[model samples]
Target: MSILKRDQGGVPRADPLGDAAGTTALVLALNKPVYPVYVWFLAESAFQLSLLTALSMPLYLVVWYVSRIGNSRAARLGLVIVGVLDTLAIALIFGRESETLAFLFACLVLSGFAFYRCEVWLSRGLVAAIFFLFVLAESLIGGPLTPITAGDMQNLAYLNITGAAALVAFIALRFPRQERMG
Candidate 1:
């Protein structure tokens, strides 16, 4: 089924602004890596950041777009996998002391949103589980907790922002399915 399709009653439903608002809030809440990325992109040469963003964002979006429209079990599993990878990336990027606060905040916000909005308990549980798993894994990896340097920020920023996008898309795909069924 197309992600755009309406209910069986054939009545077109207005788009919920809450979803957009939630997505924006989620994106904005994850400011730790994003702020640094933006600064790095501005402070240093823009070529690499620009190039990476252009190349990566579209590919990520396409995966999300396809996942939204495709009901195949594989697509659903893929969203879960992407969701896991995104959180893992966040943990790796923000494992330091100064950044850890932001990381914890982002994780709380994302998981809380998922818990509140996701109709399926399975989805909610999966999100929560993966988040804690990554946190624990990062702790076990045992790197010194320090602030991100400008050089590290560049790559981390890309990962953080794009990961947010992927996370949004993953939720979008999962949450809408319950509405359609009901």
Candidate 2:
């Protein structure tokens, strides 16, 4: 019951993008956990991080795809395509070196698109995909930008928490009240 209207087939046409303010808030919120994970990965080895990413990403995609089966065929198909692209992007982020930051930035941009344009499940799924990709990439790419100091870690945490709070508030305002009430 968002700003969406139905098509001639009686299908609920989805929003072309998400609410601008809401998606922006969600992006900030979703990007929070990357700092700590990046820090932890830097403390560890890139090999371990990549291995972890390679293992976990496929599992997550499978789970996410399975969970979306109840949706309409078109929606499910769209989710699968996005999920596959996301998986490939994640693999590239983990597989390559010195490009984690770039990939993370790209994923975040996609996250913004997902939040604004896609359905709720797709929006949420895209965020999850971005988080894992960023974490894996951050872990592999060790450099000046990577969080090393305690202060940097703390600052990242602070930003993430603030973003999360804002995201929650915006989500509350953005979605239909009846959906939640039901």
Candidate 3:
């Protein structure tokens, strides 16, 4: 009886996007560290600025690629390729100016793949951990490579980690779910 009434329904319905318990919270957390640093100083050096852009832009592109590819496994494989390149790139960033950042660019592309494949906290955590080390390395030893300002580097780290987290969240929410397709 009451079941047929539109106005008097019980639980009614749930909104999926709103159900994202922590999307706004997480996005806020991710954006925090970078904004203040922006006020402190601009990007330290051409090299560091290049490094951040090199890492982020390619990733954004590759994610678009993964979406078109549509198969999750295929996307995972792409991520693997990107990961391998990233490993090589990190080595080069410290090792030499020309090759290092380029290779790291490849790695960021793979990160998109990880975002596509991973759907939970631990998966995202692994990516975050790697990023933490990546930034810490840039801070502690990067001065040897070229002149970059400390404030710039801090901002870079904030942007990188937060951006990466945001990437994972976007991937989780927007990806096509076959289960939901029907």
Candidate 4:
């Protein structure tokens, strides 16, 4: 059997969700290292944000490994949890001014696409979690963890908005399409 067509056991290898998850993991991992350098370049004061991004790399690797083993649901859950937590961390660290909350919206969209129809409940729960985090960030969290000038905050905001938009677009493009019925 062709390697592309089968696993070592000769079973057909077909796991769209797993493939998507693995690809997401790889993309995130590859891009994550740049965040710190980029943030430092933008504002040395905001370097902590880069550290937070760096910390999330291990979680992405875990997601990749889970997907590689064909545990798509676990990988999906890992991605949602990691994305939600990472966005929340940025919000809490930089406060609302950084505009990092935009990433939470991306997380919400990610949760929606990460699961299938049969896993609707899981998807809903993840969406709710994202919403809850958004509310907590907007209402409960106040002020930046460290003092950052308005200009620095604005730079971070631009970075965040662009990052969130890219994340949402990636999710839309990478996930498998579903048939629509009239």
Which candidate number maximizes TM-score?
4
Work out the TM-score per prediction. Answer: 0.41, 0.32, 0.38, 0.85
Q: Which 10 successive residues of model 2 have the least lDDT summed? A: 15-24
Output the worst ten-in-a-row residue range by lDDT, candidate 1: 11-20
Q: Which regions in candidate 1 have their CA more than 4 angstroms from the true location?
A: 1-37, 41-59, 67-80, 93-95, 98-119, 141-182
Q: Which RMSD values do the candidates have, in order?
A: 8.7, 12.1, 11.7, 4.8
Top lDDT prediction, candidate number: 4
User: After aligning candidate 2 to the native by TM-score, how far in Å is the CA of 74 from where it should be?
Assistant: 15
- Count steric clashes of candidate 4: 0
Model 3 misplaced regions, further than 4 Å: 1-41, 47-72, 87-144, 176-182
Ordering by lDDT: 4, 1, 2, 3
For model 1, how does the per-residue alpha-carbon lDDT over 78-170 read when each residue is reduced to its tens digit?
434443454445344344321322333334334434322223464466657766775676566433234545655555555555555554565
lDDT of 2 by residue, 1-182 (tens): 54557556433444222223223323333443453365354433332333333343443344334434433333333433443454345334333333333334433443434332324565566668767755765566444322234554344334434543554455445544432212
Q: Which model is ahead, 3 or 4, in terms of lDDT?
A: 4
| Winner of 1 and 3 under TM-score | 1
Candidate 3 lDDT over residue span 32-116, tens digit each: 3453354235444534434432453354245335434443433444444444444445444433322233333323433433432
Instruction: Tell me how many clashing residue pairs each candidate has.
Output: 0, 4, 5, 0
lDDT (CA) for every model shown? 0.42, 0.41, 0.40, 0.77
